[model samples]
Target chain A: MNASSLPRWIDIGLLPVLNLIAALTVAGVIIAIIGENPFVAMGVMIKGAFVYDGALGYTLFYTTNFIFTGLAVAVAFHAMLFNIGGEGQAMIGGLGVGLVVLFLDSVLPPLLVVILAVPAAAAFGAVWGVIPGWLQARRGSHIVITTIMFNFIASSIMVWLLAGMLMAPGQMSPETRSFADGINLPLVYEVLQMAGFSVSRSPLNLSFVIALLACFGVWYLIWRTKLGYIIRATGHSERATIYAGHDPAKIIMLVMAISGALAGMMSLNEILGVQQRVILNFTSGYGFTGIAVALMGRNHPIGIVLASLLFGALYQGGAELDFEFQTITREMVLMIQGLIILFSGALAYLFMPAVVRIYSSLRKPTGSG
Target chain B: MADLWLQFVLTIDATLRVATPLILCAMAGLFSERSGIIDISLEGKMLMSAFAAASMAALTGSPLLGLAGGILVSVALSLIHGFACVTHKGNQVISGLAINILASGLTVTLGIALFAQGGQTPFLNKSERFTDIVLPFAEQAEHVPVLGTIYKEIISGHNLLVWVALFSVIVTGYVVFRTTFGLRLRAVGEKPEAVDSAGGSVSGLRFQAVIIAGVLCGIAGTYLSTAHGAGFIREMAAGKGYIALAALIFGKWRPVPALLACLMFGFMEALAARLQGVEIPVIGNISTDLILVLPYFLTVILLAGFIGKASPPRSIGVPYIKER
Candidate 1:
């Protein structure tokens, strides 16, 4: 039986769930190897992610970053491009956000500064991303290798600027001065309070709203727009796209720019909403995590949102697990993440033959009955 | 003038020391990529091997045991890469990325669990690590003039692993270009169907290439932990794997050119280390941070055809699906 002949639920929902279970099972074995009870750990993680006070807010805060980055990866995936430089793009985007707030917060209104910073961040990230895209399209450079190189270059650039010029006065750490007063996005707790609904304080902010908007925007752009058609066409077959008289190179560069812009928006959540300063390594492997989220989400906006929430829970819960267990640390989340990527992204179809076999056999018996 | 010459010599010496791992890794990448397997997980494998090497050395007080342990761990990872890319026919890049992430997380997690020192293994003493081996007549040559100074300062007193790195390049050059297996490996990368027609198992040959890569990366990782440094710290690979990948591209994926590229990057790093806080006549103080970006920046430029073209294996990154 053809694998694609499976039911929609099996293809889109059941398969991913099964893969997630496979990843979790492997993670459980690892936890056991480290002298911890996997079931107890899972319970603690669940409680920490949802049951604890203010945990949902923390999870949502993390979910916002993943949404931005997952969308970034998904957009590139539609164009058959892998923009792995999201970490660098986000860092540069934070720099743009920092520069704007630092220069304009006192001179201009806070809202105006933020309005300008969004495009500025996108533009900076686009420049970082489009260079590699252009190289891939025109110069025939491999996007993966160039993007990886660009990541290193971005890190070095960040270290240089932060340590030398951006370093706050009288501070030894490599970070910029905090943004001007009132420059922050509204925290979710405060927003809830304003609406007469009390909630515990967490880092969740108005950026979460922007992340949702971006998702809606991406869904519309990818599924409904003519440009999205061209991008998907280019991904399907560049030769066919060329036969249709569209310039695939231009499409590649444009899609990468958009992808980079989405990645760049992550800074709004981290820098403008939470940290309020451009700090060293603030992206903190979130860009890479975006790859897993995008893969597990199957590059759909709705799937990405759900996947982001799952990862957000894992991240929040993993922190709690670290505090509860002597052997397990926050790195345990990273291990689980790797396992998820392995099972979902790389070995996604490892169990497909068995699944198809079982599905066909069960369906045949039911149909005969 | 004498002092400046000594400084130059010392910088070259530093270049040799720093370039050893890059040389080894470039060779490893050469084997993997030439055989049509994209091995971006080179960093992950080396990092994991470094942790394993450090842990074993700390436990057993033997550098040899550490080297074996490192190689064993690295080969196991290479097998996983093989299973994903070859057996499952998965996205080669994603599989490599997954392994890299897995290694990065697993190393730190296991390190914390085993040693409880905040993701660091116990430091090794001289007996547990590969110390510098002084060449014969080093003291006698040091007393001689310019020629003697060059011999003693530039050539003598490197760890055993450094020589192994150099030797590995020669072996790689011979094995890649001269042997029948090398010819089959190259053929599989470029045209797997042709090799298939010739009754050669493409996957089998590719697996051998990845295993060779694994061994070289293992040696590189062991060199890092037991020879270059005392123990494993978190992320001890520190982008060296990526740099070596760049060097491989910069060298156009050949053994000798890749070694030279590694040396060039090593020289830049050595110069950066020496030039920190040193003011020049016009440029003033050149930031080491910018200098560190040179190799990556150069690779991008090279890839962009600003200098030369870097043509990879034709069938690279494409999974071979046997035609029905």
Candidate 2:
């Protein structure tokens, strides 16, 4: 049967099912090659990610990082800008927190101090985006190349600074000092208990709340505001936007800065809410995964959140795949991630064009009605 | 006099050895980009082929067969990108990214399955690996003037792949500038709408160009794992494709100038690799990972001035929408 004969639109819940199915197809092949039973490994991953104590908590914890970066990438996609420099932005954002917390830690009260750190990190991340964004808008530089280069620069600069001026005292830790203990996200477990909400363990924290709020804010900005209108307009047709008297260059620069600030928040969230310190190589390909999330979500904020959770499960589960299945390596899980992104981003356009056409045709008369 | 000559000899040798893979990959980018596709997939193709070449060479005990195997696999990956972007009118950047992520996963999976070690192939024996070709004239030519010294040090005593890269550059320059197919390829990149109306198939031309790129990148990957160095390692292409993309843009997609851009970046990387232990005057000792960023930083600097002005082929990233 043709794709059109199936449901014209998948249920929002079913999207994950399709993604999981597609992912498993790729993973199943890899598992077979590795001489492992795909079913047993899948079962173990489920147990590892959900049934085990703290497994689900860690899953949501990982998702907290994803939401920030995913929102960061999604914001850029709203304006047809690809913030390929998210990794660079995160590093600079982390450094911004370090710089701010290092000198300004004692000057301000703890609560206000944490509040101030967020904007400072945003500003620092914006600086990282500014160069590539400027070049892209003014010089016709491709964001893909420039942003990739920016990541290298940020990582280099971080390594240089950490080894010299930024190294923590007695820090036998190659990382910065733990954030002043006063700066902390209240233990999620305590916060939940204080509210009289009971659970196995608290994985949801202040940053998780912030991540959800950021998604709502981004959604509002993109769909409900004049600036958002301009962004959507430019993404659709730059020439048309210029014809309408909006400056495309300024829009690109502004949109990219906003995107970078969102990503920079990943650093603040992780450092203040969890890690309490900035370290080299602290990011675990979260920025790169954000690209995958944003694309699979079709640049929708809510869609990105769901995609992040799925990946969160994969990452948490994949971490235990080695223990559960002797033959299954972590690399097999990566194959699943790659396949999902491949089908969603590039292959999807080809995959269901006929269905999309049919659905649109069916709606045209009703929309006109 | 002897010291100065010796220094000169070493510099020339270093330049050629470093420039080989860069040249090959840049040539690959030159073909794909010249035909209107912005091939960010070159990175993925190079990476996957490097893994394939190394693994096959170790398994089969034949370097030549390994080289062929690498080319075939890369071509398959490149063709998928070509089909998606050129045929489906899908976003090129997204498709390129998908291929890259796919390569990363597949290579790692293959590596772990075969080697059972962290995403790395086994080290090769000398019999299975490509060794340096010692020219008969290399030792004999040491008696001549500066020319003999240059030959003995730089030109004569290296892997045959280095010679292939040098020859490939000249041949690529010839094919791009002089051939009818190259003219059609350039025409399509410059104005695909016109080419399409003129009875040339845009998709076909783009596919041909991408395959050319894949083949060159395949050779470059094989060289990286099998010839110049030994055995495939994880993510060994390590931003070389992006550097080659920068080189293509810096050279305005011309073959010879593109070769120069590759050499410049390659030279910088080689210097960084060599300077791992030596302390910089003020900075003191730096980690090799930190030094690796130097080429990327240089790319940004070069792009800020020169790349902004370089005119890309007009139809570079756009899909050829017959209706639009």
Tens-digit lDDT track of model 1 for B128-176: 9999988999999987988888889888999999999999999999999
Interface RMSD per candidate (angstroms): 0.8, 2.0
DockQ of 2: 0.57
Superposition TM-score, candidate 2 onto the true structure: 0.92
What tens-digit string does per-residue lDDT give for candidate 1 at A240-350?
789888999999999989888888889899998989889999999998899999999999999999999999999999999888998888888988998899999888888
How many times do residue backbones clash in model 2?
0
Lowest lDDT 10-mer window, candidate 2 chain B? B301-310
lDDT per residue for candidate 2 within A1-369, as digits (tens), equals: 344354635423344356557767777877777787788888888887888887887788778778888888888887788788888898898888888887777788778878878887788888888788888898777777789889878988888788657788886656877777688666677776789977667445677788888899999999999889999999999997899899999999998898888888778666776777788877667787788788777678888888888778888888888786555666666667777766676665554555446656886798841
The residue pairs found clashing in candidate 2 are none
True contacts kept of 1: 0.73
- The fraction of correct interface contacts reproduced by each prediction comes to 0.73, 0.55
TM-score of each: 0.98, 0.92
Error of 1 at B170 (Å): 0.7
Candidate 1 reaches a DockQ of: 0.82
